[model samples]
Target: MTTVGNRSITLEDFYQILFKDNAIEISPAAQKRVSDCFAFLLDFAKEKLIYGINTGFGPMAQYRIDEHEQAQLQYNLIRSHCAGQGKPIDTVYVKALMVARLNTFLRGKSGVHPDVVALLTAFINRDIFPVIFEHGSVGASGDLVQLAHLALGLIGEGKMWHEGRQVPASEVLAAHNLTPLSVHLREGLALMNGTSVMTGIGVVNLIHSRNLLNWSLVSSSLLSEIVESYDDHYSAELNEAKHHPGQQQVAAQMRAILQDSDLVRKRHEHLYDKKVTADVLEDKVQEFYSIRCVPQILGPVYDTIASATTVVMHEINSVSDNPIIDKDKGSVYHGGNFHGDYVSLEMDKLKIAITKLSMLAERQLNFLLNNKLNNKLPPFVNLGRLGFNLGMQGAQFVATSTVAENQTFSFPMYVHSIPNNNDNQDIVSMGTNSAQITSKVIENTYQVLAVQLLTTIQAVDYLGFEDRLSSVSREVYQQLRALVPVFTEDGIMTEKILKIKEFIQAEHVQLPASVVGQPAAVAATELVAS
Candidate 1:
């Protein structure tokens, strides 16, 4: 269990320790540390007139502030920067963002009052997450706008949705018997001058993109087996000849996935004219380039995602807060630690991988939908031509449309930057926008995958008991068969598609017992089986 009150803070703590136990409170030790640091910062400001403490910030740094106006300066900073503009994220994610920001502040290096920590701790304990928009963060200068929106509600200056109604933060805090902080210190800068939102979302996106890549491989293997694709695309010699690490890895995985498929040729027999295979007589045959090049199309996306995950994990564990207080030197030097270029680039790559996978799944669905393309399979993988078996027309439509939407969303937001913050923030990273874009790309992938799942199952039934699917795909087929049986008529496919979506994201695939050693979960299971 992760408790903010009873633990020492560390990078490791944020990555693995703080989850499941969301109850956050300042322990006596943490309170003392925060109090001591806040006192030091105030002393420093009084003596030195630090850049943003006793004076105005950014372009107005030269303007001096009176003692009575210091609190107002910080308040003004929060009020002016609440510029986020988009749909709110999942409550779970909002909670995660809160946790990330709180944990970073608890390091006692951000110069915020202890009472401010207590206020955030209360929000975490009570599950009162502030609504934050996806847009408005430039990913440079610490997600300023989004963090400002988050802080506004904390100061009772903005509205927050609670118990199904938008209400003032003051009322919610009063009702819950929690008090807002009396002294406005560096809490606004502390909250805003960090990469918590990008880091939080990036870490989660890393995990998801990795799993989605695996599922893409799993899905690709299934389609190849269903269409009886050639072994040429995955040959070790072919990939080794060029040896791009990502491409080689993907080809290897494809080979492993189709290892025991009887349909894979022992050798290439003849010309493929889209309608036939081996240029010989066979009802069941090798499919066209769309099906044959499954590995070629999907393998690179998988590799790119894996590489991106590695980069993102390192980034999440990083200390990305500005003005990092040095205990030994007793100085707080402001720097661009929160600049989002690194994160945004990786997220852009994530967008590409996600969009490509959705496109691959859509292509597979197209192959299964066309009888001429699907060899001798029934129209739309229908088990009966006389209206007895329902085709996967609805599911196919969803996959196609979902892919189209994903393509549109993949437009790079990071490339679009503008000067703002009185020109102090001239060039922006838009890292948060990159993260938001990738999130939608991930959702589009789910929709596309759901459709492919429906088509694969339908195609299996179309083949009937006469043809045995590959060992890997057959196991996957059985799992779906248990939930969604062969559609005897044109019934609702939405429910079935939804079910498959849940199963993949939940990692419900099974591992073979015959494997020498492997984890029991489908993550290891599907990889080994494939």
Candidate 2:
């Protein structure tokens, strides 16, 4: 089924809307819930004692104020928090934040009126996103500052980007037959304090990063086999002895992919056989830890994506609003469930996994480039020109730089909490920085793997006409070859590498990662049994 925007927002739907160019919908039930919250707040405003109504917020939640000065309170809350510094986040991420914020309000517990929810929902379905900055949220009080800007925009009070045009939210809404929304009771706080900002970013980034891990494996293993490393390194017996389930899966997959290769033959003792060279048994003796230790590493990547996904999925589906309704008890429970610690922990782990994958990709490229280690290939696969080939020096440089950046991104942002709001938020999650960093890590990872692909195709050319690769590897080479021709003269490797990256992204890279990470990989037993 095509993913539409609603509470049922899965990672696939997220991919569809965020990356795959799919549209979304605002369900009727969700609209009703949103409308109900807004209506309740409007009637409840008669009691100005409501915290965040005609009263000061946060550390001053107990302070009472005159109803006449109430409108300025909401505006003041947004303007003061607009202190977010640093470059703006990607526009797509900003849209995700809007969608998530709108969805949470749909759960009907926030007491926001239906009209306000309908407006936010319309913004999502119609692709209208508020301008949100990157560095404002401390992530403890739930992406406070950035989301305040979003809330302000929802009420037609802040600025937004609409249909490729930037305009004041009040003007845009007015132009579209709308008006600034009424914020009564806890409506402003309901819109502002939640994990929507970070959770939306976390899911989109983690899923994409997870997909890149798959691509990194595909690129790395292609280079590993091209270098003619022993298939024995992927033996099930070795992995089974270690008994790591992930490693077992990786070894098995490698064995399966390399199954029917003519290249995997036993050495013949005949003198005539000596004339034809196969992969050297000694130099190919032990595959490097980068290739052999893949499952052990990428297993963690898989785990990170899964773990983060679970937390974010729940965050999106449920009512993250404070003072959650309890019709059964006829009361509300105000709590800190809105705190984003869960998302922070998962994002930090994701950052590490992404960094590891980028480094592995760069390491794979280095192996392919080092002629001394790559069996008999020229340094940097000089591509038969020796003196004339520009080769993959530039691709290698980019891969190195990208991986370095990923390492820098992996530093845990969650640990650095700053006090805010009169010591009320003495501790924080920094989930905002964590999620944003996770996004950057994924981008760096893409560039790193792109370079590895360029170098791997070069290594494949250098290993030509040898004892052939397995049918599967041969087929994969065929796909890659469609984009990257043999690097015989090295005209422009950059475009080729980029095109291959696009190809890899177009298809979900899951199966290929499994193929390379075959922890249960065993030797070719078919011909021996035959």
281-341 per-residue lDDT for model 1 (tens digits): 6644445666666556766665666556555545544456667655436777778888888
Model 1 per-residue lDDT at 61? 82
lDDT of 2 by residue, 145-177 (tens): 888888778777667887776788887787777
TM-score of each: 0.82, 0.84
Model 2 — which ten-residue stretch has the worst lDDT?
520-529
TM-score of 1: 0.82
TM-score of 2: 0.84
Residue 315 Cα positional deviation in candidate 2, in Å, after optimal superposition: 2.4
> All predictions: root-mean-square deviation over Cα?
5.1, 6.1
Error of 1 at 386 (Å): 4.9
